[model samples]
Every structure is written in structure tokens, then in C-alpha cells.
Target: MRPVNATDRTPADLLRSALATDPARPLVTFYDDATGERVELSVATFANWVAKTANLIQNELAAEPGERVALLLPAHWQTAVWLLACSSAGVVADIAGDPSAADHVVAGPGRFEDGLACSGERIALSLAPLGRRFPQPPAGYADYAVEVPSQGDLFRPYAPVDPEAAALIVAGAELTGAEVVDRSRADAPGLDLTGPGSRLLSGLPYDTWDGLSAGLYAPLAAGGSVVLCRNLDRLGEDALAKRIESERVTATAR
Candidate 1:
């Protein structure tokens, strides 16, 4: 089989390459101090979640290419899965954006009511410690845990995704799928994120380019892994340093 060229690949394609290169390597580690939660995912495991979530978007929600999906959640591992799922399904991920303008909305419990108000279909995620199903699902929304499990483990988009089509809207800028890939490729080396395994610890919000780069794109582009921290402000300096030491974080993005 011919090897795929990196320049020709999308951000989603980079994830597949990461899985192929080292399926057992940790792709993401997440911590939420307020919730006292910690979770880690290997490349293969992360890719599986992405596939299942993509199936939910494609099969159940009937999300078409170029559709907009509003992501109303925090810096959780599942949020990473949703981001990749949107890319794989060719849907634009609107991170913490106005849900009213979306074709579909995925929200955590804190944003569930607002998500329901949107005219589009909704997927509610508990974002519970282990990504558990909601105790009581909202009347009209699909519970991510309940529905995503039965979906196919493999995903193929119903139509070809145009790399030039808008794929992300964040921090008041919109980027096409190809632009995201190009930018990540160009910026990764400069960010000290190049990897055959770099480990990055990031305390950035997902709503901005810097945060997205540190938390998602950079690591994927460089074949590195990320330790994404939420409620980082709540952690004392000593605790933070200990986390870095234990996780073997090679770089810090604040």
C-alpha cells in the first residue's frame, strides 16, 4: 500500500495516522478539578469514540456536510471526541457559540436548557466522570451515552467533505478544514509541540485559537499528546507542579 502524504491529509486524517503509528499511546488526558475527574484515552480508544460519535451525527442526526454543530461544553475528553467527530462528518464545530444558529447542538448539563431552545436537533452530554448517561434525559434531546453506544464503530460520511468548506468557527474566525490542517502543520513546530512523543499540558479554554491549538490541533499535527486541564484556576501551584511531574508533561501552554 502506498503511504499517504501528510500535506494531503486533513486534521481528521492526522488522527488516523496517529492511531496507526501508535494505537496504544495516550492521545489525551483530561482533568476537571471542580468535578474531581480524571480520564485518559489512547489513540485507538479516542478514535473509536470519534467513530461512534460521528455515526451519531451522520446516522441519527442526519447532519450533512457543511452543517453547523454548536458545541457547548468544557475542556473534557468527550469534547475532543465531538470536535473530531464533527470534522469526520464534515460538520462545522461551533465551540461555545450561539446555539440558535446551528443545525445541531451538543451541550453539557450546564447548557442543556439553552441547547434545547435552539430550533435544531440536540444531543445532551452529561460529561459525568465516566461519560455516563444523564439520569433523566431531556424530553426532546438525544442522550449521547445512550444513543452513541449502539451506533456503528466505523464511520463513513454520506458525502465527500470538501476540505475548503468551513469546518470550524471559533474566537470570531472561521476556518476551512484545509486551512485548519495547513495552519496546524505550519504552527506545530513553532509551538514546541513536535512529537514522536511530546506531551503538552494546556490550561486554555477551547473557544479561542490558542486554546484549540494547544489542546487539539497542535498535538494531532505533531503526533504529540495533550493533558487538558479544566478549572485549572482552582489548582494550587504545588498541585499543578505535581500533575506535570506525574503526567510527564514536556510543555506547558497557559
Candidate 2:
């Protein structure tokens, strides 16, 4: 596996490096025990999602560089996509942030009322199986599932992304794109992610910096993959053990 380079100052850079090394390698494997749903994304597939979503953020939402998008979704696969999309688009992703203060907002079905507070563009994610659209589209909100499919497979930012610009707001601390990458790389060792094929199974939410690092950034920076589990506590101990064995998880972050 190729190590993250000094030129890789942002999360998007890390992703690009991974895609270059092994496009077919699994990057993220998501599980929702409550729904009995599982979705796997390879490096290429995940990059495709990031590209389309970034296009949505730029072309549809009209979000400019440095603008902030309040992310009101849970620790799901789409939320991970949005995080990378925000980076690729040069916008900031505020996890579980106040919608009223954002330039745009992305919310799940349960947060529609809160999403309505954003005066700018609003995107709603159904988070249903197969990333389905809402049966009834919420008024004033663009359905992400419907809009993303038509976006181009490639993405180019309208403006250059400054590594110094704020890229994420997690746990009340703002981090620049460079800083996020730096911290993620620094945390890899602590998480026991020691190079290629290191697999970490994480049940942590995305609300905090720690969770974000464990669930996505650390494994990514270490040239490894992640098994992200939502509603993880609902699974019985025996079931969880079986899952760990089946997924070949090397470590766990709870």
C-alpha cells in the first residue's frame, strides 16, 4: 500500500492516493444491525460517490469554497460520503450542527424540521435501504438519492482548495483540511492501524472527532479499510462475534 504523502494535505487527497494505489480495494463496509443491511464500497465506488456528491454541493447547492454545510445525519455511509464531498467541494462539514447558522444543510428524514431552518439549499437523505428516495419528497428539500445519480462521475473544484481553510467542525473544534489529515495520520498508530489491509470495526457515532477518526479517517490514512457499524449495540454478543470473524476485523473502536 502507498503511504499518505506530504502532498496529501486533505481527506480528498488521501482518498485520491488510495484510489491510485488500488481502486478495487474495499474502503468502507457498512452495517446496520437494526435493519439487517450491509453495504460495501470499494475505493473506486467510494470515490465516485464523493465526486457526484461534490458536484451536487457545488452545482446544485451553489456552495462556494469555505462555505459551511450543517450535516444533521447519523454515522451512516451517506454521512461519510458527505464528509468527503464537502472536502472535495472545498466546503466545511459541520457534524450535527445548528442548521440556522449554515450556508446549506444535509439532513436525514428525522431532521427535516431542523433542516428547514437553513435559508440556503437543503438536501434530505432518506437513509433507507439502497439509498432510496423518500416516498413523499419533503417540500423545499432536494432528495439526495434522486439528484446524485445524474451527476458526472468525475469532479473538479471550481476553486482551488486551500489546505489552511476550515474543512470540518466536529466536537466543537474547527480543523483545517491539512490539520484533519495530520491528526488522522497521527491517530492511526494509536488505533493499531499499521499499514495495508488493517481492518478496524467501529461502532462509534460521527458526532465527535474521535468517532470520525476511528470510523473513517484513521483507517483511511493508514491505507486500511473500515467496517462501520450503526445500531451496533443492538446485536447480541454472539452475533457480534460472528460478524467480527466474518469481516476479518483486526481491531475495534466502540
Candidate 3:
């Protein structure tokens, strides 16, 4: 089996490559039009978040390789962090997945009740600006914002992640880590993410493969970045145009 490394065998590898190439470059710029909120994460900062979250998954949750983690979250930046964290920890992330069968569950405020169905460790994300913790912690659920801060800044999976092992389940398809990387590389050119400083503006949700590819994977595979927009339909054309220009977006997937 191929090893997961920075040269590109998995999504974690893509993130590592980005961090190595330009740690200061903004990797993910997120906007919540409804709340008029914006946040930007550089490659280094993003990697730190991934590392800490991966530590939380591997140590606190004790989630081993091949364990399924139900991600009941949306297209927020924290959600993206969790996606890569799962890769780093050698766990399978099931997007909008069934919680009951998962080894662990990461849920947003809206999906808190649903995550209760899971028998394993449960984590909740407030998804608030600056990753603020919940005002009051939910019963039986660890608050991600609170717990992640205490985790290690670096992560190394207890068990090596097999590039050929299952990594993601999305939109009715299961993809191994290697396959996800391969597909992302293939999708980059078509998504117009092969150019220098390619920045994609994506208003798509995270439920489907297309959304994940355009919003996160494709840009990472191409050594580019993304501007993730939530409630984008609520933004007027004028506002959207200004955002495109201000964000230096070269591609769009809505």
C-alpha cells in the first residue's frame, strides 16, 4: 500500500503540500452572507487546526484507523478542518452521514439531536465566528471549540493511514484516500484550478462530491485556494461581484 505523504496520496497530503509551498497564503476564505461574517485561514493556521482536531480525534475519541466519523456539519471552515482532520487521523469521514453506525460524530448546533443517536464519542461544533464555544455545553457532547484548544499543535496518527484505505463517504459513493486524491487531481483542470494563484469562489454545499471537489479538494490538489460562501444566494449580484474582486477569485462554482 502507498504511504500517505506530502507528495499527494491523500487529502492530508494535499494540505501538507500547501503548507510546505506557502504557509502564509490564504487557503480557505469563508463568508456567511446571511450573518455578514467573513474569516480567512492561512495554510499554516489551517494546518494547526487540522493537527489539533486530529489529536482530538485520535486521543480523546480514541478513533482508530478505519473507524467511521459521521460529519453532521455544513460547508463552514470548521467543517473543512474536520474533513482534513479525519484524513490526518486515518479515519473515514461520512458527510451528512448516519450517526447511529459511526464510531464518532461531529455535529453542528442544528444536528445536535441527530448526533445523539451515535453510540460512540460525540463532538459538537458551534460554528460561530472565531470558533467560539457554545454558551452552554450540550449534554453528552464535547464542545469542539473548547476541547481543540487544549490538543497538541502537531498530530501523528497512532496507526499509519493507508492511502488505499477508505477515507470518505459522500453523495452515495465511498472513496479511498488515494482515490480521493486522484479524483481531486483530475478535477482540478476541469474546475479551472490549474492556474497560478487559482482561487475558486464556491457557493455550493458540502453534501455532494462536486461541492467538496470545488470548494476544497480540487483547489488543494492544484495548490490553489478557495473562497467558501454560505447563504450565498442571499447576496445580491453587486455584492457578489465585489466579493469576487476583493477575494481575487479566478474561478466560480455555484
Candidate 4:
């Protein structure tokens, strides 16, 4: 339910934009994918979570601005929050995953033929399980942890985000530049997913146009959140319900 307008804003713009005018609305509903239980996150609560998560990424994870980050996560609620927090804090979420192809296959934009490449800045991250003990941070990371209680909304503002600055780093070379905000739209519905308030439940990865845009970007663009479950055990309905119930997500693309 979006009006036709020039949407140059990244998925991050959504929650803040909504918070600017509507902070008390029911912005998220965590539904148990299996049992169908629900927990709604008010606008203020969602904003708080985003700020806290963003702080963890920026301060603890040392996610510098404009850096390309690779998110290797299965479809669930946490993935959505990670994406939105990154967007709000100006961290590029260059999501990567395998579609319905072989385990060795991955998503690609085939832009290497366009004559562009990485500028020697690349990071790969795996959002490990909070269910188990923390795993080692990927290469180049300074420290790592599986979970941290809310960093809270008591953090500082991040560096100014250059709208066109690279907000992503996927298979496409130099994924996105500071001058390419206008072109973030994939010219495909699947690529223009949504922002917070929406729900995208899947046990798959966020690599395909549908998964990335609809699942990650769409909800955030709409001032909503994303939920990425491990999708382990193929994600039964009970697990999905738990995420939705905990997050209080409303709409969903998947």
C-alpha cells in the first residue's frame, strides 16, 4: 500500500520517516510461524530496537559508514531488524544467499561485465545463533558476540549517510555508490520489497530479488522490520509464529 513517488530513500528511511510523524502506531507484530501467536512492537519500541541494534553494529561491531557488509542469514525476524538498523545507521547491507540453485550457487547482478569492481573494501558476516554460544567473527572483524541486550537508544547519531553512497555490496561490483540512490529501485516489484510493520517469513536466504527487496528492503522502506529465523529444521509453522509473536509484525511479502 505505497503511493507512487520518487523513492530514493534506502530501506532505512522508512522507520525514521514514520517516527517523525507516527511513533505510537503498532509497527511490528511478532507472530509464531508455527502456533500463530503474536506480539506487537509499538512504533516507539521498534525505533528503540533499531537504535540499539544500530549501536551494536556501529560501536561494538565497528561497522563503519559506507562499508559493504555481506549478510549471510536465513529468512526470519532478526534479519529484518539487522537490515533496518544498518540502513538507519548508514551501513551497507549487501545481502547474499543461494536461490533455488545448487548449494554452490549464489545471487549475482552480472555487473562485472559493466566494468566495475570492489575498491578493496569488503566484509563478510554470519549472524550466528543466539540459541547457541557465540561463534568467531568473520575475517577482518575485531570482536564478536552472539547476543547483547539492547545497546539502547542512548547512543550517538551515526555519520551522515550520503544517500547515494554504497548502501549495499552483493554480487554486483561496487554494489552501490553514493550517486546511485535513484537507481536502487530494481525496476521490479520483487526488488522493491518494503520496510517495517511488514512480515517476511521464510527459511531461505535473502539473495533473490524477492527475498532481498520484499523481505529485507520492503518492510524497512515502509517503516517496518524484518524477521529472519535460522530456517533451521526447515522452519516449521511453530517457529515462524514465535518470531511474529515476539516481533509483532503486521504485513509480509513472503
Question: Per-residue lDDT tens digits of candidate 4, residues 77-169?
Answer: 455566667676676765552222111111112312121123332222233333223255333332223333547674454676666666655
- Per-residue CA lDDT of model 3 for 1-254, tens digit only, reads 11224458989988887787789989999999888889999999999999999999999999999999999999999999999999999999999999998999999978999999999999999888878889887888999988999999989888778999999999879999999999988888888886449999999999999999998998888888999999999999998999999999998999
Off by over 4 Å in 4: 1-8, 28-40, 97-147, 171-204, 222-254
Tell me, by TM-score, which candidate is best. Answer: 2
lDDT of each: 0.87, 0.93, 0.91, 0.49
Best by lDDT: 2
lDDT (C-alpha) at residue 70 in model 4: 53
Better of 2 and 4 by lDDT: 2
Among residues 3 or more apart in sequence or in different chains, the pairs in candidate 1 whose N, CA or C atoms overlap within 3 Å are none
lDDT for residue 32 in candidate 1, whole number 0-100: 93
**Model 1 Cα lDDT, one tens digit per residue, 60-171:** 9998998899999887899999999999999999998788888999998778878876788899998888988878998778889999999888989888778889989997
| All candidates: TM-score | 0.95, 0.98, 0.96, 0.56
RMSD of each: 2.4, 0.9, 2.8, 8.6
Candidate with more favorable, higher TM-score: 3 or 4: 3
- TM-score quality measure for candidate 1: 0.95
Worst 10 residues of 4 by lDDT: 100-109
